[model samples]
Target chain A: MPQVNMTVNGKPASGDVEGRTLLVEFLRETLDLTGTHVGCDTSQCGACVVHVDGKAVKACTMFAAEADGAEVLTIEGVAAPDGTLDPVQEAFHQHHGLQCGFCTPGMVMSAKALLAENPTPTEAEVRDYLEGNICRCTGYHNIVKAIMAASGQDVSKIAAE
Target chain B: MYAFDIERPTTLADAVKLLAASDENQALGGGQTLIPTLKQRLAMPEVLVSLTAIDEIKGISEDDEGRLCIGAATTHAEVAAGAGKYPALAALAGNIGDPAVRNRGTIGGSLANNDPSACYPAAALGSGAIIVTNTREIAADDYFEGMFATVLDEGEIITEVKFPVPEKAAYMKFEQPASRFALVGAFVAKYADGVRVAVTGASEEGVFRWSEAEAALGSNFSPDAIERLSLSGDGMISDLHGSGEYRAHLVGVMTKRAVAAAG
Candidate 1:
């Protein structure tokens, strides 16, 4: 086992983990931050998306040892300390962005990264950026709408609740 | 994934020395493809030498000859943002897997693994890029051997890749919906002297140069130039996604599309 240290959601965290331990496993099992879901263990399903050094990456695809001494942001750290929801979460709530909610954490993380890069992305851009985050229940209609709304764009043109 | 010892060396020399130290050591670049392979028990390496931390192999720049020089550890996202000099190559990097994948997956990793349907192979072969390793430089033609295979010896690390900018170029891929990998893809690059057409994803022999199409387009430089040209299905990959004949047909279609786009 290797001792790895990283900043998780603004907190310095350290743990002893196997070389093959995935970053997702370290976050969920070791650090007890289960907000980052793993919908598919494979890299295709972006359900394990997290921000490592300001860039969104699949947590399940990277090893914990590889992320040592890095800054990592998970779904648990998205909102304010006062428990107020972030704009993306608020929009998701308002727009019904999730149904079963298995994929909301990843969808939100991916959307946050997208909005950070392109503050005013078009509808097509939003759809394109979320290609990795798959929402099987919502059909992605409301997820797109929520992301657009989070970017302070007009989401009325998007259909559905 | 099976248990293994991991080493993250900040210097390229140290990384190379560690890889050379043990026969079971495997180099890890981004680990986008290799990690998945390891999870399936496909490979068992005793020491995993990670190369992402090496500063020497992590940037995009252009040399005096105007060729694009990309470090091996440079991520796809970095290439997508920095490789503006080569728009076709940048576009291919941008559409590799997805946003997250683009953020983590590196060009060196993609080229080293040499997945048959990988987009970089087409770009490298089409542009006549040179792969610079720790030991020496290898032409794209000599680098790729076959599916999941390359000419790189153990402990030989790809430090950088130099790509010759073409006058006009484009890559067109018919993606397999599930994996987003090219079912059949073609990269068309037109230079001053000649044209190169590299095809991937459709061949059992891995990425290959479509010389007939290249010869036809070299003179005329248009989709109609290779309209009558066709490929044999003898060495084509046939899976549930497509048949050998279907993929063979797609090669022509993608090549035409690539030429039209480049033109």
Candidate 2:
């Protein structure tokens, strides 16, 4: 087993993991930070998205050793220290962005990454950025709205509809 | 996934040395394609040499000749954001797999793996890129041998790729909606000397240049030039998404679209 060291959610963490262990497995099983979900083993689904060194990446597709000595931000780390939700999460809550909640964490993480890159993306950009993150329950209409609203846009009619 | 010892090397020489020491070793790029294959138990290697840590082969810059020199470990995300000088190449990188996949996949890995549907091959071959390896530089025509194959020898690692800047170029791909891999992808580049047109996802022998179309488009440089020219379905790929004839048709359509879009 290889001992891996990384900063997870602003905290230093170490775990003994096999070379075959995926980053998502180490995060959820070793550290018990289970907010990051795994929807598909094939890497097509974006449920295991997490930010490694400020860039969003699919955790399931990377080995645990790959994140060694790196800064990792998971869904559990998205909120402020004072317990306030991230603007993306808040927008999701306000806009009814999720149904069944299976895909919300990955969606929020992906959305946050998108906004961080482009703070004021247009509706089409939001849709294009969300191409990897799939949401079967809400049909993605509200997810797009929530992302736009998080960017300070007035998605009122979209939310109402 | 089968268990394997992973070695991370900080320098290109060290990576080459590590790879040379192992008889059964695989080089890892961003691991977008390799990891999935590992997860499916499709490949098993004694040692995994990770190229991500090597600093020498990990940046994008232009050479003295104004060619775009991209490091082997450079991720698609970096290329998409940084390769603006080559807009067609950048656009192709930006549209690969998805956001996450783009962030983790690399040009070196894509070229080495040489998936028939991979986009980078078409870009490299279409633009007549020079494939720089640890040993020597290989022309793009000689770099790619066939589907899932390249001219790289055992323990030979790609260091960088140098692409000559073209006057105009574009890539057009019709994707399989679910997988996002190209159903039929075409890349066309026009230089002062000649035009190069490469098609991926349509050929069973892998990414190949449509010389006939290229020859026709070189003189006229218009959709009308290839109107009478037709691609045969003899070697085109046929899968669940489409038949060989359909893909052959798409190759023609995509070529014309790429020509129009290049300008």
Candidate 3:
């Protein structure tokens, strides 16, 4: 087993992981960070999305050993140390972005990454960027609105939930 | 996925040595496809050699000949950002899978896998790119064999790919929404010499060049020239998503769209 070391959520995390142990497994099992859901073990569902070196990546598709010595950010890290939700999470809460909440964590993580890259993304850009993250409830309209509102855009004129 | 030992080699030489030490050691690139395949137990390698840490093969540069030289380990996102010299190639790389997938998947892995529905093979074949490996450089023409196949030898690693910038080129993919794999994708590149048309996802034999359409567009560089040239359904792939006839029809439609878009 390879002992993987990474800075997760501003803290150092180390664990002995098998070659087949996915990053999602290491986060959920070893670190007890179950907030990163694994909607699909396959890479299709981006529910396991997390920030690896400031870029959003599907944790399920990457081995724990592959992210060795990297900086990771998970859903659990999205909230401030003071217990305040991140702007993206707050927007999702206000806009009813999630239904079952299974995909919320991944959605928030992916939305953060998108905003970092393109601060003022259009509604089309938000929809396109969320292509990898699947929302089973088909609750994409609110999700898009939340992402847009998180970018400080007005979602009031947009369709209501 | 089965249990295995992974070695992350920082240098290409070390990676080659590690792969040579064990014939069962497989080179892992982006893991976009390999990891999923491993999860399904489709491939069982004794050891996995990761090529991501190798800085030698992880950037995009242009040679003196104005050709785009992309390191094999360069991620699709890197290519999407750096290959602005080749707009068509950049667009193809940018639209691969999605943003997160593009961030992790590499052009080298995509080319090495040569999935029948992949978009890179079409771009490479159409642009006549040179695939640079650890030992030798192989033209895209001789590199791909068929679906899920390539000419890569055991323990071989692709180091870089060189693409000659064409005067005009574009890739239009009709994606199979579920997998985002190209159901029918066409790449058209027109150079000073002639035009090249490569089609993917539709053929069972893998990515192929439509010579008749190329010749038609060589004289008249427009969609109208190749509009009358119909592709045959003999070797087209027929699955639940589409029939051979449907794919064959798409080949023409996509090629025309690519030509128009390139113009």
Candidate 4:
């Protein structure tokens, strides 16, 4: 077993993991942070998307050992400590961005990462960026709208509210 | 996935020593391909030696001669972002699968695996790149043998790939709707000596050069030259995505587009 020491959701965390353990497995199985789902074992699906070192990555495609020293942020980390939804999360809820919600965590994660990088992304760029995250439900039309709406709102304002 | 020992070697020599210890060991670069294969039980290696920690195996630098040296562990995102000096190569990298795949996939892993639908082999072959392995530097023509096959030995690991700066080059791929892997991809390079055209995702034997298109375009690098050439479907791959004949037709279409784009 590999001993991994890393910061999770802004807190120092440590765990012993098997060689075959993936980051998604560590987050879901060991840490019990089951919000990150594994839809496809292949890298094609972004259902396991999470921020490692502030960059979005499909956790399923990465070995837990690979993220040993990295800082990881999951969907659960995006909300307030008081459990209120973040701006992007609220936007998704307000705009009905989710249907089945199987892919919601990943979709929200990808959008958060995208907005973090580019506050105002064009619709085509949003479509291209979210292409990796597959949504069998909602067809992504409202999700794009939610992301645009989220991008316009101030994070500080959302936090104050 | 099967249980296996994983080793993260910090140095090239250490990696070599780890790989030499057992023939059942596999070198892990970015794990975009290897992880999926392992999860699906398609490949079972007793040990996985990760090359990520080795600082020597990452980065893109240029030699005094202007040859672009890309470390084997350099991610597609790095290449796409022009972490190396080549903008065209970066553009090609950006067009690969998607941003997530680009972030985790490495050029060395892609070239080493040599998936028939992969986008790197076409660029490697088209640009006359050199595959620098632990043992020797193999030319692009001699490196790739067949599907998922290369001249690399069991313990051998690709250290870097050196691509000669071309006069002009471009790559065009008809992506598979579902997987986003190339259904038919063509890379065209017009160098001082002649033009080299390579086609991937169409050949059953992996990436192959289009001699007819090359010969025709050697005189004049243009889409018109590609229109005159006929790509045979004799040894092309036929799958649910596309038939051999359809792939052959796409080879021609993509070649014209790539040639036009290269201009």
Candidate 5:
């Protein structure tokens, strides 16, 4: 077993994990950060999406050992340390972005990653970015609205068009 | 998941040495494909030589001959961002398995895996890229042998890939909604020497060049040049998603769309 070390949610986190231990497993099982979900095992579903070194990556696809010494940001760490919600999380709440709530964390984390890379993405761009994050509920209409609203777009006109 | 020893080598020489030493060791790339395979127990290697630590094979640059040289370990995100001169290849990389997969998946992994539906092999073969390994440089024509197969040796590590800049190029992919793998993807590249057309996802033998369409479009770089050259359904893949005839038809459609979209 390799003892991996990384900064998770702005704090030092380490664990003795197997070589096959996925980063998601480390977050959920070892660190007890259950906000990150595992919707699919095939890596098609982005439920395990989180920011590694400020970039969007599937937590299930990377071994915890691979992310050693890296900075990780999950849905749990997206907000301010003072419990204030990140703008994207706030938008999701305000716009009714999720229904099942299973894909919300991954969606929020991936959305933040997208916004970090591209501040103001177009509607098509948002849709394309969230392709990996599958939400069975909400039909993705509200999710798209939340991402757009997070980018400082008007949601009132979103429905009219 | 099977327990395996993970070896992180900072140098390519170390990686090769580790791989050569182990009887059942695998090279680890972006882990987009390898990790999933590990989780599924499809592949159980005794050791894994991670190429992530080697910084040498991790950038996109142009060589003296104006060819785009992409390091094997360079993530798809880097390729999408850095390959500004190769818009078709960039676009192909940008849309591969969404943003997360792009962030982790590498061109070398995609090329080496040679998933029949993957986008990179199409771009590499279409642009007439050179697949560079630790031992030798293999042409795109020879590198791709079949599905999930390449000309790489057991201990060979892909260092970088070299691609010639074409006069005009574009990739058109009709994606499978669930997996984002191309149902049928076509990459068309027109150069001073000639035109190359590569098709992926529809073939059983893996990515292949559409030489008939290429020959047609070589003289006339227009959609109409290959409009009547629909490929036969002999070796086209037939699955629940689509039949062989349908995929063959899509190949023609994608080729024409690629030709029209090229520069």
Candidate 6:
């Protein structure tokens, strides 16, 4: 087992993980943070997307050990301290970005990461950026709208207050 | 995935040594492809040498001669963003699968794996780039031999890839809707010496230069010149996403677009 020490969801965390343990597996199985779903073992599906060092990555495509000493933010981390939804999350709810909610966690996380980097993204840019996160339910029309709406909002000010 | 040992080395030399020490060891870069393969049990390496910690293999730099030296471990996002210094290369990088894939996938891993549908091969092959490993520098022409094949010796870690600033270049791809990997992609470069056209995602033997198009475009670098050339389905790869003939058609179409974009 490889020893891994890193900050997960703004908290210091450590564990001895098997070499074959993927970051998604580690988060879901070990940490019990099951919000990050595993829709496809292949990297094509962004259902296991998460933020590693503030950059969105496919958690299924990364080993738990690879995230050592790195900051990891999951769907859980995006919520407010009082458990309220983040702006991106609220935007998704308001815009009806999800239907069955199977792909909601990954979609919300990907959008959060996107807005964190680019607060204001064009429609084409949003579509291009979210290409990795697949949504079989929504057909992506409303999800794109939610992202654009969230991008225009002042997330920092909302988070601060 | 089966159980194995993972080693994260801090230096390139150490990573190479680790890979060299074991025949069953595999070097891990980005893990965008390797991890999924492992999860499917297609690859069962006894040991994995992680390259992320090696600082020497992770940035972009330009020399006095305008040649760009990109660290092998530099992620696609970095490449896409940094390739602005080299517009064609950046544009090519930007067109890779998506932002998430770009954020994690690295040029070194992509080149080392040499997937037939991968975008980087067309760029590396079209640019006539130089791949510098820890041991020696290998010309791009000599580097890729076949599908998922390269001349890289075991334990030889790629440090960086050096790309010449082309006089003009562009890349175009018809991506597979499901996987986002290219169904057919073409990269064209017009250097001071001559024009080179490399086609990927269309051949059974992996990325290969389209000699017919290259010959016609060498004299007249134009889309009209390439439109006259013929690309057939003979010996092409056929898969679930696209048939060999369909891929061949895309190759020509993408080549025309790429050549036009290069101008």
Q: Tell me which of candidates 3 and 6 scores higher on TM-score.
A: 3
Supply candidate 6's per-residue lDDT for B224.
95
Task: DockQ each candidate and list the results.
Answer: 0.90, 0.83, 0.89, 0.67, 0.84, 0.75
Please provide, for model 2 over B59-94, each residue's C-alpha lDDT reduced to its tens digit, 9 standing for 90 to 100: 999999999999999999999999999999999999
Q: CA shift at B38, candidate 1, in angstroms?
A: 0.6
Off by over 4 Å in 6: A153-161
Q: Write the number of the candidate with greater lDDT, choosing between 1 and 6.
A: 1
Give a tens-digit lDDT track for model 1, residues B1-263. Answer: 78898999999999999999999999999999999999999999999999999999999999999999999999999999999999999999998999999988999999999999999999999999999999999999999999989999988999999999999999999999999999998999999989999999999989999999989998899999999999988889999999999999999999999999987
Of the two candidates 3 and 4, the one with more favorable lDDT, higher being better, is 3
By DockQ, who's the top model here?
1
In terms of docking quality, how is candidate 1 classified?
high
Error of 3 at B257 (Å): 0.5
lDDT of 1 at B221: 96
Please provide, for model 5 over B158-201, each residue's C-alpha lDDT reduced to its tens digit, 9 standing for 90 to 100. Answer: 99999999999999999987677999999999999999999999
In order, the Cα lDDT scores of the candidates are 0.94, 0.93, 0.94, 0.88, 0.91, 0.88
lDDT of 4 at B115: 94
Misplaced by over 4 Å in model 3 are none
lDDT tens digits by residue: candidate 6, A1-23: 66899898999888889988889
lDDT of 1 at A68: 98
Listed per prediction, chain B TM-scores read 0.99, 0.99, 0.99, 0.98, 0.99, 0.97
Rank list by DockQ: 1, 3, 5, 2, 6, 4
- State which docking tier applies to candidate 6: medium
